[model samples]
Target: MFLAWNEITRSKLRYALIISVMFLISYLVFFLTGLAYGLAQDNRTAVDKWQADGIVLSDESNTNINMSMIPLKSLDDVTAKEKAALGQTAAVIQLDKKGAEKVNASFFGINKDEFLMPDIVEGRAFDTDDETVVNNSLKEENGFKLGDTIKLAGNEKKLKIVGFTENAKFNVAPVLYVSINTFQEIRFEKVDTTENARINAVVVRAKEGAMKNVDLAGNDLKSYGIQTFINKLPGYNAQVLTFGFMIGFLIVIAAIVIGIFIYVLTMQKATIFGIMKAQGISGKYISISVIVQTFVLAVLGISLGLLGTVGTSFVLPTAVPFQSNWLFFLAIGGAMLVIAVLGALFSVRTIVKIDPLKAIG
Candidate 1:
């Protein structure tokens, strides 16, 4: 340890450059993870925020939320079987903010007093059919002010934006919460009968053995657990799989590069190590020093990488979905450290095998 510390301290600039490499790669890993997580949240934040166990939908819809339409008659049976409520009508919001200005959004038609309704971060929750609560991103994207009246571009239905909620989105777009009354009106275009207000799905709360089975009106409707439902969200799997592969590749590539770098450095010091072994200084001693050096480099690098990520967060705007999950960061950092340590081990055999005669020459 002392020998390793002595050399590293003596050649600060050389090790600093090496440490910088580790730092940059680690920062990329962490940043990409955050970006991937943010994109996923954009797809399902609204659904995730709902404290429901499962989602009920029409089986014939083939897991497509937009295609699924549950009949109102099944509501009583579903409610009796488990706690439940209605929500549907995902749409693009084309309010008349300016000529031809439109915001991509998920328009959720939900009961005013249900778990699906997220708490208001600004203004107040929707109370009547005429009011709608939107995600915070809308304030910037469309210049939406609280209590401002805007009309849906294609539907011609005017409603007031009364509140803004945080972390509510669907399919990478902002979420707009409205009354089931308004949902039916916008979706159907006519307010003739209750049957016209058919919804896409029921957000339900249930546990194993919680209720008796309830039929979803013929063979067209069924329910799924929350995680299964989330996995089926559009682009959710592809995005996650792609990013996961990127992160995995980075860690592995970094390990090989770092291991090779450390091994080359060890080979260059063959003469010194050879002399030390010849003088009974022990290959084990020098090998231990090399391990110590690798450990120091990893710790210093990961620390700086984490600090850099946190600083980047401050400079980014709220419009960017960069969520700082400390646990995730720690896990990534830990993996980097482990890979680095394993990389360091590749030099041990080289150190032990140094030829004293060749080194002396």
Candidate 2:
């Protein structure tokens, strides 16, 4: 063990090269994992915040919330089932500010009275019909503040920014909250300059056991051209599964690369190992030394890789959609360590097979 450590310390250039390779590979794995997680969260953050048991869309539109429209009359029909209420009105609004870039923002029209608006960071929630809340991410990017008026969709309607909230993005765009009336106006436009269009979907919250039965009411909304309840929002499950697969592939690749590198390094030192065996040094000692060296390298590489990932995350813009959960980090770290140790063990077989007589010749 002492000799192995001394050899590593003396061959600074060689060890440094190996560590650098490990570092690069590990960093790539972590960065890919972070990016995959970030994208999945970005794709579903808005729907996840709804905390609704189910969503109702138009049958003709399939599961697409954007294309689905439910009349205001349907709200009562859905709420009659149980604890359900009209969820937030949602839309995609394109904003064009004078002398500034055109930005696409998610418009969520929530009943301010329902306490469904995202937690406020600055200012207050809407107090009037024309008031709206913008995400802090939007506020910072556009330099807007409370009481500021912003033009939407070719300056057709100017909406007031009443408040700023955190983590209220939808469909990868920052969210802005307004009254349902406003959202309807923005969405359908006034037909004949008087009547507003219907809403896109009715977000329903069900009473306990409502999901168990799988029927909202005796009306059979699905048969009536209204799409029945979807327990989870569309696109959510698929997005998560895709990201999980990507992260899993990256970790596996890292393990294989590290394992192969360590195994080859150990093989190269077979002659030296045999000489040590001839000097009465046990194979067990050589194997332990190799395993310890692998562990040290794995730890160093993963630690540095994590540091790099965190540093990169800090500079990443919120728009980039990067999320990091601690459990993922720990899981990846543990897996890397274990795989590296296994690779070291593969090389240890050569130590046991070393012929002491061959070393003297």
Candidate 3:
């Protein structure tokens, strides 16, 4: 280990370069992983908050929530089963002060008293027919305040922003909570008359002992012209899988790069190793030195990489999706350790092959 440290210290420039490369690669992997997680979370944030066991959509609409529509009658039919909170949800377009046409916003219309309403960060949940709640992030972005009015979908009547909530987003859009009647009014364009337009989907909460067979009941819902209840909200599994694959690939690539660099470095020192072997130094000592070098590089590179990730996260814009779950960081750390060990092992083969007699001659 001392000899290995001396060699690294002597070749400061080479070691620095290799460590820099490793640091960059690790940082890239960590940053990309965060981005992927943030994107998927933003895409499904609204649905996740519902905490519903199942969602009912139109059978003809396939899995696309935007195309799915369930009339009030259909929602009633499904809710009649038990433990279902039938509500309306959709994405609506509104404009910010910049007049940028079409800022997507999630519209959730439920009974004010439903348990699914997100916890409020400021103000309160909407109780009156005309009042609505908007996410604090969205409210801050648009410079909205309590009692402010915002038009929805070019509707002549503007909805009052009565409250602000935290961490509510849908399909990457900030969320707004309104009365089911108001949601139906804005979406269907009829406040006084029922024009046959209903909710896009119905959120259902299953009761205990109400049959644990969600798949069977979901299939049954299809018979009513309503799409089967999506057991898990759409896109969640796919999004997670996609991100997982990306992060996995990145880690593999980083490992490969580090292994190749370490192998080449070890090969360059083969003659020196042979000389050391001839001087009564055991092969075990040489091998241990190589392992020590690997550990040192791995620790230094990973520490720098983590620092870079943290610094980048701090300066990243809010619009840019980035999140760090500590579990993910720990998992990445474990993976890095395993890969670094594997990389070090690659140098062992070269060390074992050193010919003491040939080098001494």
lDDT of each: 0.80, 0.67, 0.72
TM-score of each: 0.93, 0.84, 0.85
Model 3 lDDT per residue over 116-193, tens place: 677877888887878888887665565667886677666764678878887777767788888777877777676633
Ranking the candidates on TM-score from highest down gives 1, 3, 2
Residues 172-201 of candidate 1 have per-residue lDDT tens digits of 888889987787888887553455458788
Q: Once model 3 is optimally superposed onto the true structure by TM-score, how far is the C-alpha of residue 172 displaced, in angstroms?
A: 0.8
**For model 2, what is the error of residue 98's alpha carbon versus the real structure, in angstroms, after optimal superposition?**
2.5
| Weakest ten-residue segment in model 1 by summed lDDT | 209-218
Runs off by more than 4 Å, candidate 3: 79-102, 192-197, 207-242
TM-score: which candidate is best?
Answer: 1
Q: Supply every candidate's count of residue pairs whose N, Cα or C atoms clash at under 3 angstroms.
A: 1, 0, 4
Q: Considering lDDT, which of the candidate structures 1 and 3 is the better prediction for this target?
A: 1
Candidate 2: misplaced stretches above 4 Å? 1-6, 79-97, 191-197, 207-210, 213-215, 218-243
Model 3, TM vs. native? 0.85
Model 2: per-residue Cα lDDT over 1-361, one tens digit each? 5766787899888777777877887788788778777776665565556665566556675566666666655555554233222323344343434576566777776566653556778988888756788878776676677887777654376678888887766656777777777776666554222332465665555556254433444342432122232213456567767867876776677667767777787777777877888888999988888888888878888888888888999998756767887788888888877877786787788778878778556
Better of 2 and 3 by lDDT: 3
User: Residue 106: error of model 1 in Å?
Assistant: 0.8
Clashing pairs in 1: 59-220
**Candidate 2 lDDT for residue 34:** 83
